[model samples]
Target chain A: MTHLKTKHRLLADKAMLWIVCLFATLTAVPLFAILGEVLLRGYDQLSWSFFTETTPTAYKAMKAIEAGEPIPGGIANGIIGTMIMLGMAAIVAVPTGILCGAFLAENPKNRFSQTVSYLTDLLQGTPSVIIGIVTYMWVVVPMKGYSAIAGSVALFVMMLPLIIRSTEETLKILPASLKEAGLALGGNRARVMLKVQLPAAFGGIFTGVLLAISRVIGETAPLMFTALGCSFIRFSIDKPISAVPLLIWEFFNDPNLQELIWGASLFLLLFVLTLNLTAKYLAKKWNQ
Target chain B: MESVKPILEFNKTCVSYTKQTMAVKYVSAAIDRNTITAIMGPSGCGKSTLLRAANLMHELYPNIRVDGEILLNGENILSMEPVDVRRRIGMVFQRPAPFPTMSITDNVLAGYALNGIRLSKAEREETVERCLKSVALWDEVKDVLNKKGTFLSGGQQQRLCIARALAMKPDVLLMDEPTSALDPIATAHIEKLMQELQKEVTILIVTHNMGQAMRISSKSMFMYLGELVEYGDTATMFSTPKDERTKAYLTGRMG
Candidate 1:
């Protein structure tokens, strides 16, 4: 009887494990579906022209649709614009964000630090569109125009909280002895933080920077209000620019150019995937 | 008879946490140069706090108040820059902590690197070799200078930490349970190194092991419940302690 009872319990455990496995499979099913659809629908859109040509105006795209011809345009400028905007964001945010993070980590118990920490979290929770609106009032109103710089300002606000929180968390998780050891060696607080503490937490900091970039790279709501979309190759930082996500958003609803949306979507997905993988690889490599 | 000035001195030194009573009560003591002084006590007896006060290592945390004077080389060390004090009086913790990101040679030179002091390639090489040799790790690590410090065994890592401290050429070295984490053989090696190191640098060690104190220390301090109970020459103090608490701690009768 005891042996039979044991067997029954093992059966229950096995059944529960299968249920968990089923849930896991369910979680992955949608991801595979999305990947499959993008690959199948978007592969036909890929060409030298698709990558290098500028986007056509919405009016021109509509005319092409009415004539039963495919839209003759690409996301080349959108890609470039996205790169430039995100590049400016990184440059503006990384140093300031990392410094804020160091301050939070160094003084975890101070009242002023606590206030700053709460404010950072509040900023993170604020919507990207809200950031766009704020940037518009601040930069667009002052400069009296939509500019790539304004788009970057919106994204820079987004990047700060991510970098700061990750850096603070990474530094916090380090053993207290590491800092003590450095201090005991007669190194000043500034030197210890820069040379010892920062290098030790580089893996996590790198992950944070990548995460911040990926998070803001795909943002379209903010870009719509600030960058306001460009139809041509935008070379000046003072002018408006279009990004891949915005291009996809504008073109996907048009029946003739749905494939272009998928193509841009695939490009953005690939870019994000590359960033995440690079982040993981670097974190693991530095950890070793 | 001429009296030699003690290398380090504590005058009515008291320490307390933010919410608690004193961790190290008003304690006064002196440590002579060219000798190993051992501090012995039971757990939570404030021995570690007293040891940390030597180089102001206790200042790392917030809301811990310290009152009174800690003098090094006849000057009040509390008045000096904290880094300068720490640089002059190097410290080793209870557990070995070699910076994981640094190579063995880099770990040895970390003090110099972190202090923004540049050394020539030959000087750096010579310093690393000399410090490692002093800690008896030169033969073991001579071939692996580029490898991470954590790649070594626990004992070897501890020695590497000591070498890192020694590379700074500090006037005094304070160790808190330096060998408590190692095996008996490793412990013996550390004891030997401390004995050899004292000829040039003053040494102060905190230990829980009574036998170790008996073996290596020329002077001993006994602490209990945040108070310095007794301090004197090791040989005389073991046989005839002035305080009852010290006698009880030394005897098998009580901790």
Candidate 2:
């Protein structure tokens, strides 16, 4: 009977190991498959001119893809517009988020701070699509046209809650001993937050900002309403703007514009991928 | 020894963290300038609280209420600006709480940076060297001045914290269990450093280690249950404690 029990136990262990291996494979296979498909399908469209040339009009989509042929239009205008909108979003979101986070974490009982935290939670839970629609109605429609400025407002709203939540959590995790040490060293409250608390939490806050940027860079729904797609290059925030997502949307709908759609999709994918990698690198470096 | 004014005087100081609990009650003591005064007690006996109150460090807690005057160099530190008061009386915590983000050299010079006091490059270097030497850490850490302060051993980190405190050149140094976190060898190093440091700065240390209190302290005060049980020369207190509680504590009959 004892020998029979030992054999059964060994079989059970083997079964468990098989299940674990199966789970690991299930988790990894799809990611690799998607990455492989993207690389294979997107390789032909990758070129220096893809980044430098403007988006081609409907007439230019008739041209065939040939090796070493400059893609008639580039993504330069979209790239510049994305940079400007994301930059403005960062400028608007970072300070407001950090200050709100600090206040909520440090003085949770203050009425204003409590209200701010409640609003942040509400904003975080609200749908991004709804935010985009609201921006269209309130900002873009009021101004009588789609513009980069309206898109930036939408991105800023999306970025704020992410930064605030991450910064607050980081501050909360900081050891109380650090604050006590600073105060014991004759540092006043503001001085302690500025010099000690902020520095100690710097890595986490930076990662938060990067993650927010990555979240908004490929956002389509929000920019769709705020910055309507344009075939020609335009840098003015007051005018309709072009971005990789909107370009992909417009190009993908036209069956003849397959190569252009794939090229724009590749650019957008690469941009998002680079941002994610940067976020990962920064998080690792700061965590240490 | 030449006579000097007392560096710190706590007059009928009472501290309570809660309405129902008193941490320290009616404690009065005078600490001599340029001498090591050790406050020894069992756990939760309020020795650390008294040390914190001396420098107004207790003010950080909203729930703590402190009554009575804490005179530092003939001024009531309790009434003075807490920032200014703390500038003259630097504190070292029970644990080695060196700023982890700072290098060993920067940790020593942290006070100046946090206070926005700019010193010339030469002056800054000199201060770092002097403070490190004062804490007997110069030789061990000279080669790794740029290394993170948290990389040091527990005792070494504590010494680095002491050096950081001394860099401000404060008139008084308050230590709360400065060696408790360390091993015996590190404890010995810190005890030795404290003995030498007392000659230049007024030292007030709180320790639960009775042997440490007896070895390095010149004047010792015994506290129990938030009251001063005895205050006398270290020799007299350990050899011939007057109070029954003091004798009981020294003989290990009571905590």
Candidate 3:
């Protein structure tokens, strides 16, 4: 009886192992398929003109694409526009987010911190489209036109919660002994935060920044309401701009421009993928 | 001995994290200058709490109130700014706490930087050498001064912490079972270092090792459950404990 029971257990365990492996492969298939398709199909369009030229808004470009001719233009304008908006948003968000995080970490017991933490949590749960619409009303309406600056405000709003939460968590997770050591050495509160806690949490904080950037980099809903996607190249913050995701959204329906959309999708995916991987790697190396 | 001034004095000090439960009860003791005083007790007996009260290090927690007087050089430290008070009386905790983010040389100079005192590169180097040598860690770490402080062994890291505290030029040093996490050999190394350190600054050490207290301290104080049970010269306390409770404790009847 014991030998027969043991045999039955072994069979069950083997069945469970194989079932898990099958599910694992199932979960991985779509990710690999998407990557494979993008890399193979997108490689041909990543040429010099593909990068340095602007998109043609004309419907005839779709005819050229349908005729199996090379698309006439590239997404340099989208790439540059994305850079401008992200850079602007980073300039405003990085310092503000870190400082806010520090305040939360340092004065954990204060009533104001409690209120701020609750507000930050609420803001994080709020939808991305709502933020984009709010930014459009606040900045675009005031300026009487769509602009990259308004678009960046939307991105900044989306990024705040991630940055603040990550920075706070990074600081909170450090050993109390580190801060106590600084205090014992006669460091003031600010000095302890800057020289000890901040440095100790550097890797976590930088990783958080990268994660925040990645989260917002490919968001098209916010940009649609603010920057509103222009065809021409424009660097001015006050002018409407193009971005990879926005371009993909606008041209995905056009048969002639479908290739550009695929190419842009690939760029967007790889860009965010590289950032997330780098952030994860740095978090491991530094937090060690 | 009578002519020597007390470097630190606790006048009926009381410390508590919350209003309801006290960590350190009404306890008073005087620690003389240029001498090593050991506070020995069982776990959670308030020895560490009493030692931390001297420098207002207890302020690290919010809502914990400290009432009564803590005097340093005849001035009440309780009334002074906590930061400035800490600068005058440094502390070393049970475990080696060399800043993980700093290098050996930088760790030693951290005190000066914490105080916002800018020293020239030459002066900073000189101070680092002097402090590390004082703790006898200079030769072992001189070649790797730029390496991270965490790269050192447990004993070396603890010694580096001592050097870091000493660099601040504090008038008194408080150690709370600093060798509890160390091996016997490392503990002996620190005990010997404390003997030399006492010649320059008043030392107050909290330890659970009764032999360690008897070995290095000229004066010893025994505390139990938020109160001081006995205080006297180490030899008299160990050889002829007057209090019945002290005798019972020494004999390991109860903690």
Candidate 4:
């Protein structure tokens, strides 16, 4: 009878292990596949000139081939435009998001704070496309054209809710005892929040901001409507901006543009991957 | 006892957490300056609440309402700014709660930093050394001042908290079961430290251990439920408690 029970337990354990393996593979395979495909297909087109030159005009490409020289179109302009827009979005979103998060976490019962939290929750659930449409109506239409500034506004809206929610959750996990310790040491509420509570939750808040930046950097749909597309290199916020994601989207539809699409897609993928890896490294270091 | 003025005087002070529930009711006592007064009670008694009320630390709880007066150095502490009251009255909790993110030196100087009062680097170092030495921790932690405060053993952490409290130079020190989290040897060390510290600052300690109260306290107040059952010199209170509840509590017959 004991031998039979042991056999039954062994079968159960083996079944559980297989089930776990199946679930792990199901979750991991698609991510690995996408990464593998991008690295394999994208590396072939990447070059110094591809990163440093502008998009090749139809006439310019034919002329370059006639001269038997490499094409001059690089992603330098797109990279600059993307960096500028993301920087502007971060400047607008980070402080506002963190302050709102702190207020919501610290004074959840305040009537105005509760209303703000409710609205933020609603906004967080709103689709990114809807945010793009709203930004087009409010910012792009008002300016009488699509511009980098409008793209930044749309991206800021998308980033704010994510940052606020993550920051609030991190702050909420901090113990009441830590706050009390600060207060008991002759510190007022503001002092306690700034010096003790915020510092304690800084690592989590930073990771949230980094994650939000990564989420927005690859966004194409919103920028398509808000910033439109421009081949010219322009750095002004009021001008039409060309970012890697929008460039990749435009190039992917043209059979003749397929090679450039892979290169731009690789740039976007590497940018986001670097951000995620940096955030993970920082979170681990700060946790210690 | 010397006839110097009391450092803290509780005049018919009553503390209630909710409108319907009272934690401490109409307790009156005078704590002499530079002396140790221990409050002894069972688990549910109001010893800790009373100590918290004396420092105005109870004000942090929204629903807690305190009536009557807590006079500190002739000023009504209840009427003072909680920050200022806390500056003059430092509290050490049951557990050793040094800010886990900070080093031992930083934890000791937290009071100054949190208050936005900047001191010279030399002065801050002097304060940390003096406070650590006062708590008999300097010799042990002198080489590792930059180590995390939470890295210390349970007993050492409690002493670090004491040093942190002392760095603020508060006039009155309130300890809520400060040594309860420590082992017997650590508790003995703390008790001896308390005796030495009582010559410089007034101390009000809430303890569940009757033996500890009898050992270290000059004055002992016994409580039952929410009321003060007996208040006298420790020797007199232990030998001849005026109330039956006090006698019952000390005899281990009733809580």
True contacts kept of 4: 0.66
The CAPRI class of candidate 3 is high
Candidate 4 deviant stretches above 4 angstroms: A1-14, A58-72, B1-3, B101-103, B143-148, B253-255
lDDT of 1 at A14: 100
Across B80-124, the per-residue lDDT of candidate 2 in tens digits comes to 998888888999998999998889988988888878788999998
Clashing pairs in 4: A53-A74, A54-A73, A54-A74
| All candidates: DockQ | 0.78, 0.61, 0.81, 0.69
Model 1 chain A weakest 10-residue run by lDDT: A250-259
* TM-score (2 decimals) of chain A in model 2: 0.90
* Chain B TM-scores of the candidates: 0.97, 0.97, 0.97, 0.97
Winner on TM-score (1 vs 2): 1
The count of backbone overlaps in candidate 1 is 0
Model 4 chain B: worst 10 consecutive residues (lDDT sum) = B54-63
1 or 3, which is superior by DockQ? Answer: 3
Q: Tens digit of lDDT per residue, candidate 4, span A1-288? A: 999999999999999999999999899998888888888888877898787887877567667667876555877778888888999999989999998899899886779988988899898888888888999999999899999999999999999998999889888988777887788889998888888888889998999999999999988888988988778688888988988888888777654455677778878888899999999998898777
In candidate 3, stretches whose alpha carbon ends up further than 4 angstroms from where it belongs are A1-30, A40-43, B1-3
Q: Encode model 1's per-residue lDDT on B1-255: one tens digit a residue.
A: 113789899899988875569999989998888899999999999989888877787677777778888889889987888889988899999899999889999999999988999999999999999999999999999999999999998899999999999999998899999999999999999999989999878989999999999999999999999998999999999999998889888996677
Give candidate 2 regions above 4 Å deviation.
A1-37, A63-74, B1-5, B142-147, B253-255
